[model samples]
Target: MTIKWEALLQVFGATLLVTVLVVTLFVIGIRALSDEKKGPAYASFAGCVAVVLYGLSLIVF
Candidate 1:
C-alpha cells in the first residue's frame, strides 16, 4: 500500500497550528485573570472561551 505523505503532512501541520493557537489563547486568558484591570480581563477570557469552543466544533463537525 502506498503512503499518502502529503495528506499526513497536512494533518500534522494543521494539528500543530491549532495547538499553538489554543495554548496561546489560554495563556493570555490566565495572564488577564492576574491583571488588575477588569474590562480587558473579561474580554480576554471571552476570547479564550470562544477559541476553545470553535476548536471543539471543528473537531466535531
Candidate 2:
C-alpha cells in the first residue's frame, strides 16, 4: 500500500497547531488568574476549561 505523504503532513501540522493553541490558552488563563483580576481571569479560565473538554470529546468520539 502507498502512503499519502501530503495527508500525513497536513494532519501533523493541524495537530501541532491545535496543541500550541490550547497550551497558549492555558498559559494565558494562568497568567490572568495570577494577576488577580476577577472577571477576565475567570473568563479566561473558563475558556481554557471549555477548550480542554472539547478536545477530550473529539478524542472520544
For lDDT, the strongest prediction is 2
lDDT of 2 by residue, 1-61 (tens): 9999999999999889878887887777778778877777777667778878888999999
For residues 1-61, write the lDDT of model 1, one tens digit per residue. 9999999999999889878877776677677778766677777777767877897998899
Q: How far is candidate 1 from the true structure (C-alpha RMSD, Å)?
A: 2.0
Best by TM-score: 2
The list of candidate 1 runs beyond 4 A from truth reads none
For each candidate, give its TM-score against the true structure: 0.69, 0.73
- Candidate 2 TM-score versus the reference: 0.73
Error of 2 at 7 (Å): 0.7
- Residue-level lDDT for 13 in candidate 1: 100
- Candidate 2 stretches with Cα past 4 Å from truth are 57-61
TM-score of 1: 0.69
